[model samples]
Target: MSAHPEAARASSSTPQGKPRKAAFAAWIGSVLEYYDFFIYGSAAALIFPKVFFSPDDPATATLISLATFGVAYAARPVGALFLGHFGDRLGRRKIMVWTLVLMGVSTFLIGCLPTYAQVGTLAPVLLVLMRVLQGLSAAGEQASANAMTLEHAPENRRGYYTSFTLNGTQAGQILATLAFIPVAALPDEQLYSWGWRIPFLLSVVAAVAGYLIRRNLDETPVFQQASADQDVARMPLVELVRNHWADVLRVVAAALIATASTIFSVWALTYATSDAVGLSKSGMLWASGCANAVALLAIPLWARLSDRIGRKPVFLTGALGCAVMIYVYLWAISTGSYPLVFATGLLFFGVVYSAANGIWPSFYGEMFPARVRLSGMAVGTQIGFAFAGFAVTFAARIAGPDGDNWKGVATFTAVFCVICAIAVATGRETHKVPTAELGLRPAKEPAKPQISESVSS
Candidate 1:
């Protein structure tokens, strides 16, 4: 959570530099927010079917459990609309505080809910409601965090700084995946009874730690400058739709790449556990944990690569490469080849997709003008994320009892990659643009020169 050396060096006599403290503040806040989001993702796949839902039909249980997971996506855009307004009007800092507190309370509540045996139908009902709350809070979290960091970042290092926010997301995924390792290894009876609750309950610790780090940070100079000028839009959404509509649509299309990620992570876990593949849940969990760990390193490397080249090539490479690799990755799971699965799974999710993942926070945020940047990003991404929300259902239908349908899933994922490739290709390069120039009208006419009294005479 501490500021990096670059950030610290830039923060000196002149305030015209990187906001190291503010960026780190956003980084730590995003880490906490995603921690709350991803733990439920882990639980939805591994525990929720049995823990909260009816135990009758396996297929129905899986659908209902996945439905609970999708519930959060439902609230994402709504939260985006609500929270994003304040982020544009008030400041990125205030929305972040609310996002963390709301996610923390919701996640902690999920931990305390009674099981179906204890409370009957109320168990899953409360779980869905809590997931909706988490979804709503999560809607604006990453955008606000990324906006804070990007605004505070140096012109040359926007990709690098923005990527740090997602590294927090990957860190959260690592923690969420690792949290399941011990729990999944527990005996079936005890695991279902109580083991699964430990990870969710840890939200209290995360919430407190996040608050400590995030509270000390101040508003970014970009927003402060806009405020001082009394120039911020009363309706950021109206401006976003008017001027940045094309970019908003572009980000929406690009975010479909996320479907490949959530499906590969969550639904693939369920597929491996099914009778067709018969992989122990622990083995799958280890694969996920290590893959996420690899991403911690891969994300930064890819982000730096984007800084050197452009985001388009790197993003396309990642999407296309990951699409090709999913076939082998799924094949490894189906064949029960642990060595292959472990290696390829880590390679695909951790390394390949990371190129796309790390670049997007900045890429999407850069698409809009500063005034409506948060609103445009949050609404576009969460809406694009909706496809991924139902990906479990789509993947389930695609894979079915014909578990050999790895071919079908791979083809579907590849189509998604190609679509995103076209989308990101349209984006203009913003790595050199100053934060102040973003979302503002371009200057056209040449400036008039001052005249001396002698020249006038």
Candidate 2:
């Protein structure tokens, strides 16, 4: 397809720092947003059961706590519907700034809320409410960030540039895990009483930094031209449903790849610490930290490779690799082999899974036009991620009668990874498609050379 002349010109005129600035802003913003998100997941697995619910049955309390973690995901699609509209209509920077503030406020409030001892049933209720708000904030964070980075990036390097968003996500998970390491070590009394609150409150630092970084950046020229051309949709959801339902379904299926992450991070943590396996909480957290740290290096490297190759090959390798490796990693943890656990975790989550993680922003964002890009990505991914959020509960259920069936959980994870690979295989290749021509139904052909006046005379 022929590229848009204006967009090509805009690309040529791009300032040296624009792409880097966009990538940096996205990375920092994502780190802050996900820090707030992952810390809640950590607490759900490690602390919330005892502090937010009754102590009647440990298993039931744990279930309820993990369910609360899933509640945020319930609100995400709804949040995406609204936040994505504003992002597509108003501007990416506006949505980015607002989401960070909302996330910070919600996380800080979580730090201040009273415990089950003090508030009875109200504690869990308020926790759910705050989680919903966090969900709302998170709904738009990554989609907008991905759109911002992808649109600003050079055509051939979109994979590498857009990857900074996931890199930020990994950094957030690493920071959240590191933040919990010391707290997880404390005596139960001190840990539950105050140590748990420390991480939640520290989100303010990330909030401030993300806000200042995003506040000054200009909107993407693609979006600016869309506005000038009056190409912006009045209701992006309606447009998305009418024109691009297939692509939306593709994103949702592709996004299920997240089950691997939730399994690795939340389900695996809890399972490893259960009596059946018996690893220390600190050891699991450290293993998670090491995997994420390696992902920091591996994600960008894979992303750069995707720039050279197509996005599908790299993504499929990761998806299918994750399907096989989940078993290996879980079996290692089941055997209480810490060294093997660390090594496999790094390979599975860090290297193999990272191919999908790093490529998805550019891969998925390219599926829709600028008019509905933010809304399409937000809604599709949030829905898919909703399943991912509940993957913890589902894996727990899949663990069977004894609740230690690593095989059952691994099978469940592998099934979904296969689904993601299938979805990606069905989509059009966008790595070589110009940013301007992306998402157009019948791609326009290049102009033919004109005959000279002298030759005609």
Candidate 3:
């Protein structure tokens, strides 16, 4: 089918967008949103097992705590459906503000919850509820930010502009890790009693900063033009399903690449610190922090390369590279070598995996037209991210009784990376496609008329 004519016309007539401003808003907003989201992850790995769950069975508590981390992923798709609709209909700015506030409030509340020692079953129950709220807020956060940035970006640099969102995410992860490093170093009594709560409470600062930036930010020209022309989809989810189902499916499959992240950030942290490996929590946290620090620099460079070449090659490179690197990283952790752990962690996540991480914002956003862009990206990516969220729980199960079966966990994560690579391999290349023409199928050429043999004779 052809591109939306109204959208194409609007693109031509609209004034130049504030691409840098939009990218900055996306970057800072994501930094805050994911900061709230990832602190839960850090706590789930290092603290929640002891505080929220029963101490009777350390094994079961660890398993359940990791499962709670996935609980947010389970809630994300539902949040995406609701938030994506409003983002497409009401405007990306509104949804962005709403998500930030919701995430901040929920995260802060998580810090206040009483632990199992204080409230028994109610403690974990409340934690799960808060995690679900975080999931809902995150559901719309990235998709809306990506759509806003992509529409605002210059035609030739969508990849570069949209990459800032993921860059912000890496920064947030770094921030979360850094926050936890000191907390993780506390004496066990102090650490479990009050230290972990500090990171969750700190989310308030991020919320305020994010709100200040996003409130003053201007809406994207493409969205404004669509609204002006009455080209906004009344039911973006329905429109996305009817016209863009294949792309949605492709996104869902490709997003499994996040499994690598879950394994790295959550499961690997748990494994390294477990009795079998006996690595220090602070040391592992430092390794992750350093890896994310490298990613902060690597993500933008890889994104610029995608803008110059195309999204597919860079994305595929990362996905395929991750499939191989997962083994090496897991091996490093199993060997009890901190230096090897840091080196492989940096190579796997910071450098190789970042190619896919940096490019997906643009690559996924460009798969649908402006009318359904928010909904399509939100729903597709969230569904896939759900699996990535639960992957830590699954990885724990597969890693044998000792939870030190690095090979088994590596094999499981590698399988998903391969699946993600295959999914992206089937997608349309959109880096070179004009911003207006994005998500539209190309026009087919007419067949030439055949000459009759009799007439020729």
Candidate 3: pairs in clash: none
Which prediction has the highest lDDT against the true structure? Answer: 3
lDDT of each: 0.81, 0.91, 0.92
Candidate 1: tens digits of C-alpha lDDT, residues 120-213: 8999999999999998988888889889888888877788888888888888887887888899899999899989898889898878887777
Number of the predicted model whose TM-score against the real structure is largest: 3
- The order by descending lDDT is 3, 2, 1
Q: Model 2 residue 310 lDDT?
A: 92
Off by over 4 Å in 2: 1-17, 443-457
lDDT score, candidate 2: 0.91
Every model's TM-score: 0.92, 0.94, 0.96
lDDT of 3 by residue, 317-371 (tens): 9999999999999999999999999999999999998999999999999999888
Candidate 2: C-alpha RMSD to true structure equals 4.1
What would the TM-score be for candidate 3 when compared with the true structure? 0.96
Please give the distance, in angstroms, between residue 122's alpha carbon in candidate 3 and its true position after superposition. Answer: 0.5
Of candidate 1, the 10-residue stretch with the lowest lDDT total is: 1-10
Over 305-324, each residue of candidate 2 has an lDDT whose tens digit, in order, gives 98898999999999999999
